[model samples]
Target: MADTTADGVERRLPTDEARELLALVRDIAHREIAPHAAEEEAAGRFPRALFALLSRSGLLGLPYDPEYGGGGQPYEVYLQVLEELAAARLTVGLGVSVHTLSCHALAGFGTEEQRAAHLPAMLGGGLLGAYCLSEPSAGSDAAALRTRAVREADGGWVIDGTKAWITHGGIADFCTVMARTGGPGARGVTAFLVPGDAPGLSAAPPERKMGMKGSPTAQLHFDGVRVGGDRLLGAEGQGFAIALDALDSGRLGIAACAVGLAQAALDAAVSYARERRQFGRPIGDFQGLRFLLADMATAVEAGRALYLEAARLRDEGRAFGRCAAMAKLFCTDAVMRVTTDAVQVLGGYGYTADFPVERYLREAKMLQIVEGTNQIQRVVIARHLVGPESR
Candidate 1:
């Protein structure tokens, strides 16, 4: 029953600090982010400066240890902040999520020296990061990644591979890259925190996406990209496990972003319903649109609660991978429905870019595909229920 602003849901935050932090985030979202989202998105401009602002605000590292210059907020609070940011602009919210995902490896597994050396600048010093795991062929089958990292005679590493679907691809200050170092398969993969300006690093042009045009997504290439031995994130041959753990948390971020998008669509639909009139009365007075609005609201509320439940489980140190998958699947699917319904509520007007629902609908589609597709999410959940597929 955490109090939400747009829908009037009640919130009981864990601490005064969290509540204040959320309030600050909401204010920033409303004032600084939302007003320019449409124009910026249409221009296909990435809001790198805004991310720097978030870093300065201590928002980029909320879920990590405070000792490493993070805010030390639990998933409960961090996800809610993402919800608010996403409601304003999917690019900003999802950008934060991707950045957080990029930082997960070192934060969760890096040695004290490694963390102390790099984390302070990463979390709050305005350095944007990207996660590099998905490859052109791998997709959901991460173990099938072909990117190779060979050990140098000096015990350093030289990576050679292309990482596809990378957010902030060309612009990131750092990348958490996974490359096969041993034999073929998951165990052979290892993680490294490579500088964005590393030797032989390059990026392809950003993909022309259907939505979230303000956030860049592209392929990154590492051609003999060199990194010192100190750049290794965790033990060698442990990258897949780390990647899976990061995805579990990243899924929750997606869920929160999905709920935010749905809420915004619901809000717009409701407002339009009350204002737009037919037969000399408000359209909302009609039973058909009224029921649709009701259903949309209910779906949004349910999605929000679902993600929060999963977040709470994560905060309590429970096994939440199954629940995270569920939340990602449900919330993203719900957003697609809610946004489509929002367009229906607006009728012809919704189809036009003059309104935001069309954009919301397009953006909702991306959630279904990222952080593992909805199909992949279902597979993850099914494995938890029935045990790792019949094969």
Candidate 2:
């Protein structure tokens, strides 16, 4: 809404059509989804109705080629949609992000035939998809995953082992499963598209999480789950590379979500600071509180700038992985800081569920952990800066 784009950077806003669509989506999210977020979150019930609305609106397929029933929107535009959705409810926002991540493997690696066969179902309906990468023994060290997929005589692969911390595990209609197919380690892993109804494919009960209670997380057990050869994504031994690439884009989405969450918290804080009286004046007028607002607002702007830079690099097909990781690390940390400070601004009210700042704090914590922890993000950034052979 302002000329806030960084210097020497092209301030590219969304096209007219995209702006209109975004407005519509934001309106729907605020009017329809935001109102029920607290109730559904407190009840720990998934927002099926919200997702049905999103799917019908063709948001599930944004950023994909329109020929496949996708919105054919740019990643930059699609990410803003995610941000708006997240401001209404983190559960729906993160769920959509994970679903988009799950679709990444197929869209990026699947053959034409595979795209024709699977993209429609994934993009057209309310069916959700899970990304199976983290195992119980391996979270950040993805190379240590134990799930295996052995080739059968009929050219199908029999997958066996358990995948842990799988989002949408119990509810997804399909999953992009990463399993060890050759030997132990990252170089031996392979990706597969597993149907939810496949025999021997089942999920444990949803995990009890500290936040994001509405989205299901669980352990997915693959016991002799037979998947056809065509289900294999990309080449064998390429899973790690594909996974890493997907994460680069995924991290950008997380950064955008964090920005949105922080914005919501900041807006809430500002509104409260202005109305809540203290010392015969609104707290916002006090220099101390005003400086806090300044810092929060500044962090939001910086986070927004970093994520947008990463998106521009990605859109240009440049090496954006390092930048993406940087954005993820900085933005998530900004969110944690800003959201916590927001609660501070609200004083005791922030501590209670009476305000949304408390929920923002919980949601911010998960952003640091998922899509590779903030620690891993630093490592990614450092590695990019200092080559393997460098000191």
Candidate 3:
């Protein structure tokens, strides 16, 4: 509503359209998403209808081309939209990110015919998507995944393996799955677009999560799941490259979510301090609390700026992987620290479900782990700067 981010920091949108889009996102977040977030998360309920609403609203395809039903927004604008959604509820924000990641392989590498046939539906037809890369044995080391996809007599592929920690594992309409197609290691990996209802495909019960309970994180079992040649995304050995490239952008999305979460926590702490009383005066009068809020505000602003910078690099068609990794690392880690302080600022109430700060506190840990862990992010940055270590 104000010409500012979720926090009070002024935002400089690229155009009037981008500003209006942000305002729309803000309005939807406040009225539709934030109100039900606490209740649904406590109940571990996924908001499927809301996702459909987002799809219809064109929020799901913000960064893609408008020719195929997308909004054609730049990465900078898209990342800010994610920030607003995340500030209201991490499940919705991160869900949209994962969906965008799922679309990357095909949108970036598929043939014109393939894009014509599928991209429009994926972008706006309310078809929720999941990304399957992680496995039981492979988490940070994604290149070590063992899911297999063997070409069959009909020229279709049979996918057989389990994908662990999949968001929207059970309910997605489509999935972008990376599986082994040749020899061992990353070179053997291939990306395939699989229909959710493919034969023998099944999902394990959702993992009981620390936070983001409203988002289904489960192991998806692709037991002889079959798809036509049309499903193959990119070349046979190009899947790993595609996956990594997608992560470079997805990491920025995660960074934006982290900043939003941190901003929400800071807002809660600031509000609590102002209204909360002690020693016959408002707690805001205390210098001890004042400095803590200042630090939290600073961290939120810094994280937001870092992620937006990376998004701008991506939008400019520049090499942004190093910056993306840095943003992911700093923003996720900063949210963890800032949210912890927010909980402390609320004293006893912060630890309880009575306050959203505790929820934000729990959600912060997941960001450090998802979309390549913060540890892996540092490795990415180091490798970008110093090259990989000798084997």
Candidate 4:
């Protein structure tokens, strides 16, 4: 049951197992996800049941180690799965990516004891997670965050402050939180694993978003929330580094999602063009529409290639941050263009709720803003090319 792309872009999967995994993903996406996307999104319904289904199917932990109940698949394979999910619905794909990001600190830097205690449940026990880094005042300047975690005499910590724009905020089971434990700047930060139901830890109402209403984005408040010393992830003052590492991988996820979104838009436009007759012939027969479709298809393929190249570099243990940033910038921008063209091809119907293109157009805007905005990505790429800008 191999899936075929309308654009004829060949996926270079590493093994038979990867191909089988992709087939399963596509089947689940088309059957369970795509069919309900529009209705659920319109109702602002968060699909917790679908997430449980994904967890039970071993789709939640593909990029993690099998020792902790994960599938132990490579990033390339995992990202392609994300693409399939995003093509079905952005809420599901981005939710998985955020869950992965939430688990990163403990998986990559936790002690043996901590990993033994938590990784199994987080990876496969149906627990959903969130990453808490950005605060009310520290969106782009993440290091300037004011969330504070203070040590107590009994080897415990008390955390206080608010985290803004948190995905899955109210419903997540656990959160990986970054708080200031020292003086100032990036080096002052420390990471901790906090239980969602901890005393004084609560979430504000979800945001009234323009798109992705099916996914909750809210602010989490920590009002003297307490945790044991063992909850500290990695060493104190190393939280910022851990966050940056997680973001490098997360950017690749965003790039893959953007490519999937563009692919979906292109498919919709091509199908509409081939069916809708304008002047005793299909609109697709017109040269003007044909060129638009060609450009849209080309952008989708190019975006896919860029993300896969970054994923390969990561799998091969090479320096790929610059590549990841480039992919995020280019692929998200491509989706913005591709989705807009899709709406154009659909004409007036595209602008209404009667078609999905308008929804895609709305969803595409968020990709350009998340996981570091496109402007920030360009700054990161420039730093790799000619070193950091002088202060």
Residue 262 CA error for candidate 2 (Å)?
Answer: 0.5
TM-score of each candidate structure, all chains considered together: 0.98, 0.96, 0.98, 0.98
Candidate 3 C-alpha lDDT tens digits along 1-391: 2367555579878998999999999999999999999999999999999999999999999999898888999999999999999999999999999999999988899999888999999999999999999999999999999999999998899999999999999999999999999898899999999988888899999999889999999999988888999999999988999999899999999999999899899999999998999999999899999999989988988998899899889989999999999999999999999999999999999999999999999999999999999889989999998999789
Better by TM-score, candidate 3 or 2: 3
Tens-digit lDDT track of model 4 for 137-193 = 999899999999999999899999999999999999999999999999999999999
Candidate 1 vs candidate 2: the lDDT winner is 1
lDDT by residue for model 2 (8-87), tens: 21234557777777778777886998999888888899987777788889989898887777888888788888877888
Worst 10 residues of 3 by lDDT: 1-10
Superposed model 4: Cα runs more than 4 Å off: 1-8
Off by over 4 Å in 1: 1-6
- Worst lDDT run of 10 residues, candidate 4, spans 1-10
lDDT of each: 0.94, 0.88, 0.93, 0.94
User: Candidate 1's residue-wise lDDT over 1-391, tens digit each?
Assistant: 2555655867667988988898999999988999999999999998888888999999999999999899999999999999999999999999999999999999998999999999999999999999999999999998999999999999999999999999999999999999999998999999999999998999999999999998989999999999999999899999999999999999999999999999899999999999998999999999989899989989988998889899999999999999999999999999999999999999999999999999999999999999999999988988888887655
**What TM-score, to 2 decimals, does candidate 2 have?**
0.96
